[model samples]
Target: MSSVESVEEFRAEFRGWLRAHLTGGFADLRGRGGPGREHEAFAGRLAWERHMAEHGWTCVGWPVEYGGRGASTAQQIAFHEEYALADAPARVNHIGEQLLGPTLIAHGTDEQKRRFLPPVRAVEELWCQGYSEPDAGSDLAGVRTRAALRDGRWTVDGQKTWTSLAHEAQWCFVLARTTPGSRRHAGLSYLLVPMDQPGVQVRPITQLTGTSEFNEVFFDGARTDAAHVVGAPGDGWAVAMATLGYERGVSTLGQQVGFRRELEALAALARANGALADPLIADRLTRAWTGLQAMRAAALRPGTAPSTAKLYWARWHRDLGELAMDVCGAASLTAAGVHGDPYEPDDWQRLFLFSRADTLYAGSDEIQRNIVAERILGLPKEVRA
Candidate 1:
């Protein structure tokens, strides 16, 4: 079949499946989890994800030999878009499925693929990324986490901050300094470390949303098998960059779908609260809609589109949160729940607060600009301290 025909068929089949399955308790999961609200219905979402794996829905973009459907890029985009339209629970395995899976496929050994791909595709083994350190958030190359080879294992020691879902993850793909004196991006090794070991400690960091989805993970002599390293021992910079590249791949189309839903809901809220009567409010809403369209268009472009798309949507969503607060006016100042209750932030409040970090994570806005300037635009490099 033609690519267009296949995408449409995949969309129809996926949409039908979602409608059929999103019933009973699962139906309530619509619009429940993502970003600031990843804590919502964790167990149910995990079960639901496993159910998707059972039905061959998870990892749709991976090769069929690796337990995926071997879907084309168009089909994968269709699945994500349809999933967002259905308001399905946010996927817990996205780190594994979208980021690490592709990286492993591209640079991992055949043994690594055979051992890791199946559990990830099955959604049975959840993974978290251990890239950012306390001192190296945007400057990933400055990571100080070190792993030493001893006997038949690698012993790791260091701390990783902003580790999303590290508390619940069974494993983490860590980029640690393997060579004793290596600086910057050199002498790094990307190793898959088990989270349940005695020396791994996870401390949840509560955010403005009153949730602890992100964590600070301390690895003190934590160990993984020597065979768990991806690529050559000292060439982790290349592997990690490949993983980052996968991080900006086609799954973002689904993210935009979610953004569209949020924008529409904000518009409806404005109408209900008589905020639309204000000319300024209405204009902002229109601009937000226009921005979303532009974002979609930019995302469709090739090459440096990922960096551009990330910069665009990060700023756009942050601004959308501001608009949401403006529309809500005085009501947004108070907690949505009981006054004495443990300060729960409603959806708008959560968006407003949590989105403040959009430009900081993954790659900071400054880092993204540097990437686009130095790499994409062929500009001179920024001076290093």
Candidate 2:
């Protein structure tokens, strides 16, 4: 689309495209893959995403030269909102497209952009984040994963836990210590390492929802080219933070759409089950609706801290899940099985279970609060022991 195109035009174009193309083959995929439901229709979702890439729909916010529309912020928001309204399947390559792709674009060499951005834009390659470790999740600077430069390559050796989609990714952007004896945020290098090699192993960590959307990745002497490092060597903290910043960017509007849908459905369920008659449940539902509106307002407002957004949404969603359980009352306690599986959670059960990690993942509530305090509120930094 031309840069001059209005946001509504962009929204209409995207909505129309989804209407025309998300059919027959892709119809079943609508609302299939998302939080806790990622295991649903994997191959089909992948195919549908690739199809979006074919029509210049994927990576709409990226630069046009990098196979994107170079969409404005308003246009991007419109795109996401329209996508959610259409009930499209959750994207399969968000780690690549949102986090790594933007990081590479900003800090990567020209060669890196040429080699990496195309595949990410096309959804031909999948990527995972290798930032969090078993012992250093929220304390990202305490990463112990080490990469040694040897014979024109970086030999990485360590474990990265809670690696989302590591099993499906072709590569991972890892933050590993390159300088020996380096402590905390110092001497780290961001290396792009291949996931298909023998030195790399991904063991799925079954989540509370009884699915393994994330994994523990063991990098036993995993190797990547020396040139694969983004930014200067031993300066990975900034790059990693940049990736995290991108992680919370424009795609959130789409997420809000999903949240709204969940809220509406919960409201309906409450009415159906006579839970809405209770004043407490009704009051909670009203608050949820208003809170969602506030979230949307915060998102559009310029200079609203990203940590603030993350903190608000994570807690809200987790609360919504709890509210859902309350609405279900006794029904939420029991599991419903299909196809002889002894343990199958209904939607409400799954929401409650999966949302338990909402405040913990991405960045935990404590960490986000710290960020807001030190950065936005001008509070003193917490002293390290």
Candidate 3:
């Protein structure tokens, strides 16, 4: 007999636990000097993530059968809203819980689930998506990465660009073409590739902020068992599309809430400093808030329209970046690890720099709008090519 409470009640119970376990907020100054700073920041983020995992809030949306508390969507949303309201630090294992876990759950075999799910929940295995090759950003069908099976094993060889956190991750969920001479979307496959193996190289790409947050991953003769293949061979597009839908639907909820809260803080800073007397500053703040709210509502939709909120985030966050600099002036533009003003948080700066990817990742904004047109508006494709 399942005796779970209502969504409100569940949130209440979860909130009580959070009040007890989750400690601290954005007091992080990115630690000190060189490697030490990164290690400290990573440790803090990991601790914050561990705190969430220990209390079962990390995977609150997952069912009890998969090591979660079986929280409802309302409960999940409420949990996130409150967490962001309280300014919880970013989770180190977000990619695992948000993108990869759900994809594997839906498309992975029983053996895959048995091998993957527990470690993911426990934070033992860190996962990163290996999509968006240099030539294959918006046009995923153009993935040139090759993964051929011989001697009952997959031998992969190719380069992946803009691969975020590949250096920090232990495994990557990769999409590669298995059938040669099959161009475009055909004969592609998704495989859970282990990165710790030989012939896998990761080189970090320094961003505008000079932070090495993304990587260019090259795989040469990367070997994996046939068991690593997810779903059917050459069905990578279907799995990838489904994963993108989940990301747009569920993952964006937390992000938008966080952005909304950050915008509120931005507004408060404006109010505190008498900056809002300037109409431009006030307007930017208002627009940022409204955009985040609209995104929140759209994120709550049942079925995803190919339109997608991630595209909206990139545009909104980029706009907010310019506005943040406008409002923050010289303070926000400086390098991180320096403590001075509350309003000029580096996370925002990191987000702002990374926000460059907002419209880029999870299908570019133009692609998403095109999806809305073709799928939702029943419009025809414009490109004759």
lDDT of each model, Cα atoms only? 0.91, 0.93, 0.75
Give the alpha carbon lDDT tens digit for every residue of 98-133 in model 2.
999889889999999999999999899999999999
Report the lDDT of model 2 for residue 59: 89
Residue-level lDDT of model 1, residues 1-385, one tens digit each, is 2233567888998999999998988888887778898988999999899989998899888877777788888798889999999989999999999998999898889999999999998888999999999899999999999999999999999999999999989999999999999999899999999999899999999998888989999999999999999999999999999998899888899999999999999999999999999999999999999999998888876654577778998999999999999999999998888445657878889899999999888789999999999989999999999
lDDT of 1 at 249: 87
Q: Lowest-lDDT window of 10 residues in candidate 2? A: 333-342
| Whole-model alpha-carbon lDDT for candidate 3 | 0.75
Candidate 1, 170: how far from true, in Å? 0.7
Q: Which residue pairs collide, candidate 2?
A: none
Per-model TM-score versus the true fold = 0.97, 0.99, 0.88
Q: Model 1: residues >4 Å from true position, as ranges?
A: 1-5, 338-342
Q: Higher lDDT: candidate 1 or 3?
A: 1
lDDT of 3 by residue, 262-363 (tens): 587777777877778899898878877877878767777776464655566778877876776666667666665646644333755655665665677668
Q: Give the TM-score of candidate 3.
A: 0.88
Better of 2 and 3 by lDDT: 2
Root-mean-square deviation of each candidate, in angstroms? Answer: 1.6, 0.8, 3.9
| Predicted structure 2, TM vs. truth | 0.99
Best by TM-score: 2
Q: Report the C-alpha displacement of residue 307, candidate 1, in angstroms.
A: 1.2
